[model samples]
Target: MDTTRRQALTLALASAAFPAASASAAPRPTGVEGQRRADLGDGRFLNPVLAGDRPDPNVLKDGRDYYATFSSFQYYPGVPIWHSRDLVNWTPVTAALKTNIGNVWALDIAKHNGRYFIYIPVLVDGDRPLRTYVIHADSMKGPWSEPIDMRIDNMIDPGHAVGEDGKRYLFFNGGNRVRISDDGLSATGKIEHVYGGWPIPQDWIIEGFALEGPKVLRKDGWFYLFSGQGGTAGPPTSHMVVVARSRSIDGPWENCPHNPIVRTARRDEPWWSRGHATAIEGPDGKWWLVYHGYENGFRTLGRQMLLEPIEWTADGWPRALGGDLSRPMPKPRGGSGGAHGLALSGFSPDMFGTKLAFQAPRGNDYLDRVKLAGGVLTLKGQGSGPADASPLVFVAGDRSYEVTVEAEIEGDTAAGLVLFYNEKLFCGLGLGPERLHAYRIGQEERWPPGAPIDARRLHLKLVNDENVVTFFHSRDGRQWTKERSFEVAGYNHNVADGFLSLRPGIYAAGSGSARFANLTYRARGPSA
Candidate 1:
């Protein structure tokens, strides 16, 4: 076929896979402007109970309250705990991992012996030779213990379960299992293959048969192993949830008659690759499934956590209630969480005191490198560029928000605000000693010659109006010039494969130091 024909065919497929929003329609509200809330306020809640990059959900039911956490890859202060009582409304409780362990993936949060534990498997800086680690806390709002490397090799997701025999075990991808110690801190027995996951049809168009993320639930004299298959993120149709049941936790697992309890059969669905679910009994004793998926055309938001009701058949099988989940359903009955989600507005009176966390650093030294005093944040520059500089970053869950910061470089340093996803993918406008620097898709691009850069102090602003980021700069706080604009819907795990979220942050690169001030964060429009 000719190049033109091939390109046209590709475009057709792309359009079929992801339907574009109508041009004449009003802009859909994203990020926290009373939009994307799972609680619909009419006793009907939406599918995505929690939105924005919350993947590999592990939900634990503790008394009347429910605690949940996601796989926070490469984000320091990882595994943020969220609390919800009604299961529809959630609020961020606290971040558990303060120190960087690595790129965390498919973690399991469980309470064994009245103590909270998060079983983590990470790539250790996105390198090969994966390892599993465990962290524990006395309280959910922790004082979480430092990560203790379990040293388990070649594992991605660790699903913790206690057998009827009262022994703890972790089920992994590729139908593997390993025994855990009595304290749930270390692996005990040899890793062995136990249950072969439910087989996907050979003709199915899937990314891969990578059966992973086995969340085990033991109830009614049966051990239900819920596993995700067809790869995590690739084609929109890839990734799904399949269930297998067994009388004994050891062996002889049978696939569910209604296999694939949840899946994105079509590419055009609102939520794609819907899998990795944690089946939990809601506060009212009704069973529900919480999973993650990429919002259609908004992959940069990462896989937002989704909640759907489930029903059990008389013959002992679970079925998902809400279909495709493009709309709202009845809210979960019973208790209510105090509030759901965080306020996106971070603008404070004092810019120097802004809550900041460095990107995944090699060590704990980044804290010492940052100093705040007299309304200025002095950060020592590091790395050849932003990818390794460990730019100070914070999580913003809004779909449309603007952030601005005034930065002054000391010596050879170049510093400015950025919309960063990870080391591999990011874009923004910055200033150096000589000229303006533009970063796109993890690489620095040449700017137009003769852009003004005489003044040492530069004010940089990033307006992310629903993934469309516009860059602006100003010498004085009053006058601003638009530098550039770029759409960043692809800077997420589906394209970059980092399982990360697009975040607004500040970075200092090259030698010397950079002083940043007047940092402000405010949510913008889907104008009414």
Candidate 2:
């Protein structure tokens, strides 16, 4: 096939899957209790099996159960595990890693001989080099062991596989592999470059030839490797899922004839940068691919988990069947179902370790500074504001939602709620007893005509209607005052550096401790 003509045909095939959001006659995306739910309840479902910043999803199928975890960068008690029976509907299980490992990158999860393993890549800068580690557990709901140093060079996104000779291997980003010990505790050798990667067209608008996220799927006497090429967050058509396979773990691999199985061929598509794919055998004995993609026009949500059904070719190759995946598709058969997500109603101490209900950045050491009891969260203040205080944040999946919290300042402490991407890029309203503190993009100032705040207590609420945010404060729970509103569409990875989503959270700053109560979250449909 002529290169240019072949690429055009591929793009055409990709576009055929996408019907504009309004073009489809199928029922539009509906919600359950104001929250987005994928399963339509009529034996059909939508894309984004799990929303929010669930990028680089790694799922391990165990018997009748399915367990998954995503790349949790800087969120402590990292690599959150989710449980699913039907695959479409999921709930939080437990976070695997407790200790803070550098900036967590793409990872993979596998169950081997009754033990579960998660291959983690930590991105380190300065004088140190990038390193990958492994964590193991006797059970999914873990008492997981401390991360063991894999001690390999030039590796990221490690995928586990077993060779014909019965030796265990970890396939890494950029087509590399390393041998693992039988105990699965440590690395046995140096990393070796095996497969180069699929050749990409020079004319295609992509981020780069950044081939990474290698996941191994073994079935019917073949070891199939699914990987992401092109940069993860660049052009709309950049990131993609490509497949290659070998009879033995070590071999000259063959790329799928229909390469780049899943991609966002155009910017107008429903999802963007669709890649980092992991294939699984569905509940109905059908093959399915699970990957991550940025929802079109909403990069602030980060990359979300997308489920696409796949078909196997007669010549023993697989192809993704989900077109641009804008429309609802029939649900998979056989598996059971349940409610989809966790409730961020308040600080649920019971759901503490399992769900990242509230997470701190950089330092997981801040737990010593927090006390949660009876619907109240008290924090010992640090630094001066959200930037240095190391706030406790949670990802808000909905494009529009409302968050309210009541804070009682103790001594000099100031606490309130805000939408934070990182320390540098955040905006919120805080209480300082005598004055109301408003944090704008690059500067903090008083909300002129500063209303006096009680040192003892005040309630703060934020409504993010799309990217525009409005702050309201109340002396009593019912009586509210709208302080100000600002635009926050730029508080995302594209504007900010870290690969992070803008999250809703609270912070405490100053010398004394601050007590927070009535932290409630409600999702509203996107504003007109």
Candidate 3:
């Protein structure tokens, strides 16, 4: 090989090696696996505090601790709740809901009367409309109860609230509220339309006047209702946070003069379609809003979790203090922990639901396909290929990162790594008995089919630099050969129609089994 080629392969070798003990801490990437971190380690922090498809964030503040979760969609062991002492730093402490109820949507997490409850709104099927369910646990790290059917029909987002009458309530989409029992298990009263949504100007462009995500905060005798207006996605201007306030739960509500508290005004901004926010009091006595937004030009990464500050106006209205959020702002005080990601170097069994998950989980039976033991994952393959299989995916929040894994195929299974977005939309290379199946544009694109493989056991490496992707192979885990390079900037929600990110996935498809060992993931610095 030429000197230039040899040097490039050598550098790749060094970076792909599992991070070893070293004191060269000359400003390495902060988060686990060198992923782009939110905390800058200089007191300030950046947007998307928790990255990679963390949409519809629900944050609950309990004394000095904060527990947060998001919409899990089709992934099993859904609603993975993360624990944080500081809002900026978080780690997945547990997956609250393990049962496959349905396609989970926006939810609300609240602590009521010394017990924790999660109000989940799910869409089962076309014949059965959307319904709400409730699950509770004594602690954030939970043995959560199975979902209790609240019989809340036709609702997509459910927010919990407490009234002055010492009663519990839940607010739903389209300006409606329902009374709940004291135990926080089921709905007690009829759904009542409380207030109409804020009107948008006729000249503005938006997907729809869809009003949803009603999170209530009672402060200083005034209950603030923050809801999202405009559709969740469609236009650059779609989706925003609007607020209303009422002195009592009984009504006489008024809209915040500064309606649409936060929005993406232009297509050039860093974050777009920003909505579904939860207001939380910072540990340091300050106030902040935990929201989600699509990182512009990187929507394939999905709606990332964002943190911004909010201040109460002199006129008693709360206003978002962070500007367009194109740059880093001063972080809120009192959060203390590691950045939000888990390096997949070891599997403690707890890793299944916490950091790694299966997409489009059919049921608890899908769990039968995977076996984790001694840091090696032996996956039994099902389906003809990745499109039919429930691929194992993990959280990847970095703009640039590398995933390396050693695979030994058993039977007819095609085992390999991929950047997966749902079952229908994904791109990656799969290794079968003695051939490579290169996937792109959501399906196998085997035109220049590359060279043939002679063995079933080999080391695979995938580098995602920005949105451009490259795949390589190594026989002895050294001296890698580039298989191909492609651009994946379009592999996102806008292109695929699913609110899913391009997460690194492990797929075992076709026949027998695939044993994955020595898998390592590390976020990369800027292209060198």
Candidate 4:
């Protein structure tokens, strides 16, 4: 611990976790009606028990129920199963990979024996090669079962184990290990490197030496493993959570003398590049961990899902009692609480729910080009803008929000509302019955005087407030117009590379059809 005394105890723990957001104040982050509710209803709780861009979180539990899932990168309804009993409320259960196949990352979600699996790790794009897939389910609200590509290449974080001679393994992401076939879908060999991680201190400021998320956990007789070391997004104390154990899953492991058991060490911590973790068991039995971070300056809200509380130690090891979470605590005791999120107020236009599904960063085959009847929704045009229009997004874990919709156009479609982040970055406001385009960092400006949206229905509104967005439209919902505002904190993933998160979505694009209507959303509050 000497890089000038660990940078002076990381600036005294970032001046006690309360001095980082400053460019005049900055630090809004609150959520509930627009989602981001980490309980806090009297019994206390808060620390993203799942919020925007939930990265690498993979919880399982089954039995008093708990299920979680994240890292849905290109987002196509990919890996979305959430549901909780008392792991601090949660909802949405369904979307077990409706085929997009690429860019998805860190998943695991096991159930075993009675069945229910999900391994995934795609990343395809460009120089190709990087695979690992598997999906299965006898029930977790899913018929789930199409992936199966375990052709296992370059690896990216799998971690599903079951040994003590029961066989079946998956481990991976540098410490490697494979051989899993017995109904858990393919791969039954090749890929063993077996444990070499946990050794970080050489000047320590880190963001490299990327060990990657492993998450094994067997308990009692011991198999443990839990990983992710640095580099899961750069320095705010680059990612942590480490541990190692092994009474026998076959190995000489053993490294948790309280090793990194959860980190963030400072940057005015309110969660920031925390770690990958995943160690569950708590419906009353206690012991938790489940991780992912980055909320400090709201890394555009990308690495969320947090939940802490861990104990163990009487020589055994586990520790991370949840500090740096910034506030509220006590809430995970005896299960039984359900219904936690979803209802970004579409203001009843026949209300669709699951936050108004439209997903397509790649496939769902455009749901046969969409239609949605009654409360409108239309769609049909395609790539002429917003990076090849695949818009329909929704996973807005609030940090100030507003969204609105209406749009109508029919023959030369343009359709509106966007915030998107993947068809090569995004920006919003579209309208086309005459003109009003805007999109920003990903191009498409056109509004030089703009006033003609001469009816094909109108009304647009975006308003992020925290990220400073603005832009409005309206034609009859009472006449309004603003037009542009922009800011969006560079639209995330460090100037957009893909671990996405900026979504707000809706897009039609070129030639013939576009409907959308009423839409709504709401939230507008915290961001500092």
For each candidate in the order shown, give its overall lDDT on alpha carbons. 0.76, 0.77, 0.79, 0.73
Off by over 4 Å in 3: 1-34, 335-345, 447-452
For model 2, which pairs clash?
Answer: none
Give the range of the ten consecutive residues with the poorest summed lDDT in model 3.
Answer: 1-10
TM-score of 3: 0.91
**What does candidate 3's lDDT look like per residue over 469-527, in tens digits?**
89887766666878789888888777777577888877888779987766666666546
Is candidate 1 or 3 superior in lDDT?
A: 3
TM-score of each: 0.87, 0.90, 0.91, 0.36
Candidate 1 per-residue C-alpha lDDT over 1-528 given as tens digits, one digit per residue, 9 for 90 to 100:
011111000000001100121232222222332224566567887666776678888899999889998887766657778888888888777777767767778899989989989999988645556999999989987878999988688888999999989999988989999999999989899899997888898877788998998999998999999999998889888899999999999968999988898999998788888999899998778899999988887777778889999999999899999898976688878887456544433232222112345678767555677775654567898987889888877656456667776778889988888889888899977768878889988988877467566645677788887788899987655568987888898888767777777877888888888877656555555420
Candidate 2 lDDT, tens digit per residue, 174-236?
899999999876889888889988999989999999889998888889999999999899778
Best by TM-score: 3
Candidate 1 versus the native: TM-score?
Answer: 0.87
Model 4's TM-score against the true structure: 0.36
Error of 3 at 405 (Å): 1.0
Compare candidates 1 and 4 on TM-score and give the better one: 1
What is the Cα-based lDDT of residue 392 in candidate 1?
A: 77
